[model samples]
Target: MANVRQASWDGSPVYELENGTFLASLIPEIGSNAYRLRDKIAGRDVLRTPERPEELRASPGHYGVPLLLPPSRIRGASFPFNGRTYRFEPNTPDGHYIHGFVRMRPWRVVDTSADGDTASVTTEFRTADFPELAPQYPHDLTIRARTELNGASFVQTFSFRNGSDEPAPFGFGLHTWFLLDGEPERWTLKLPVSDIWELNEKLLATGSRLPLGRYEALNEGMNLEGQNMDMAFRIGDRPVEAVLSKPGYAIRYSANEPVTQWVVYTKGEARDTICIEPLTWTPDAPNLDAGPELTGMRAIAPGEELIVRTTLSIERE
Candidate 1:
């Protein structure tokens, strides 16, 4: 049987789930991020973590899984939803709200328990509680996340509820970074997507879609050696699946229907880590009134909730 326990990591309380063969670490205070996951028997890290505590404290987005609300970028830090306008502080140098406000906020632990071979922890965050976020988002919403480790696989489920009287637009995603055990050049990736979103110089979606001809590598796993990429693609309403394989290990990821978009990032000097994000909507979704269907944004009525789930399984060859 696996045990789920809480401990301290870099001055923050962390939850650890282990079954001798697998280990998983979750930092609830910091965006309820799962900072570490490994196959203890194979001595392989499934997720990337900051090398130093200062690095993590300095930039939390560089590692692990950080939840993204209203996902991706929003043009000029403001967007009109229904009849009201929602504004956000510019978190990116390009003057846009990059990844929403919940990623750096603390989440309340609702429960932690182990059932036979599975260990799980549930956390929740209320949007109305954050004074700094109220002025920007100004919506009454709640997000609940539950992470479960069953044997060697990890799964995360997220639920968003609209508590306000009026309907609210919703988008969500998880920015997950996977660590490569060997050279990045030797790694291969396969993504199931038909169209790619066109982006401006600032990385904001331009309301245009292009065929995946140029990205044919997505169909047939392509080597990622010298390739530089920071792109998002449309996954339609079908189930989404992605695979990343190295010499000795492979990671298979899947997301539910709500996840209609996929974002991939692997550029710059740091090539040891790759980010494969599953998003509920495209970037600048709220502003994409011309083609709202492409945005995949949903409007949840008061007291209504939307749930999304994702799973990651690691296999050794």
Candidate 2:
């Protein structure tokens, strides 16, 4: 990615935060083109790369995570547009598409500046902004995905401008991956989760949120020794605070608006590295009227724009 003029954040070929805590690298090129994060101050890796885990570095919890969506497709084949039905190609083999408008599109650097310690990068996207989007999504809209690093945080802001004559329903959030301690089972999850949506093998919701009968909140703790989750839970999406720990290290996470939903994935195994995804809506949202959320789907009026901004960070405890 260190080329003559590909337009990257601060400075390419490396990574570090102003506070000199988080570290990101542009590697794992092919599958998931993204930067990996490491908390240098804590001497702990905030994310996993192929070098760290055999199963990581590629599409693992939005590995290189991005704005709108990442790791796959934006499959909303049929969306309502003025009482009309539209279709889209499945972005991935999973059937439905994903990641809004800029997932597969490389961002064009609009601004880059670095002082002594702090650095930032801004990217923008624009197309005919309508019908072109119509073939992909049912609505016409303009979106921007920005990735920035200050101290211990990697914030991605995704903004949208509804180019159509109505509002478009949509959801956006981090599909971040947190590396667990020894053997991927030495850590536990602590959340305020009360119910989980039942999904079929396709990872689509079955139209319901059932109170956790077996999976309980980690008010105290729960072992990952025998847990497997490719599931999303309704946690109010109120910027939930969570903690992951091992022998001598711990990770405490919290976000704005108190996220109340959680999606724990086990990567096809009964157990391994768990994907504790903090999302803005339930899966197949807007697509499936399942749980309670904005559904990443919105209704915009003529010449109206909708913007979604969220923040989350890592703390060493």
The prediction achieving the highest lDDT against the true structure is: 1
Q: Residue-wise lDDT of candidate 2 within 194-275, one digit each (tens)?
A: 5777777667666666777767656566766766667777765333766766666666665544244566666665343555
| TM of each candidate vs. truth | 0.95, 0.75
User: Each model's C-alpha lDDT?
Assistant: 0.84, 0.54
The lDDT, on a scale of 0 to 1, for candidate 2 is: 0.54
Cα-based lDDT at residue 7, candidate 1: 90
Candidate 1 residue-wise lDDT at 45: 85
Clashing pairs in 1: 185-225
Which number leads on TM-score?
Answer: 1
lDDT of 1 by residue, 175-210 (tens): 899876548887888888878999999999988888
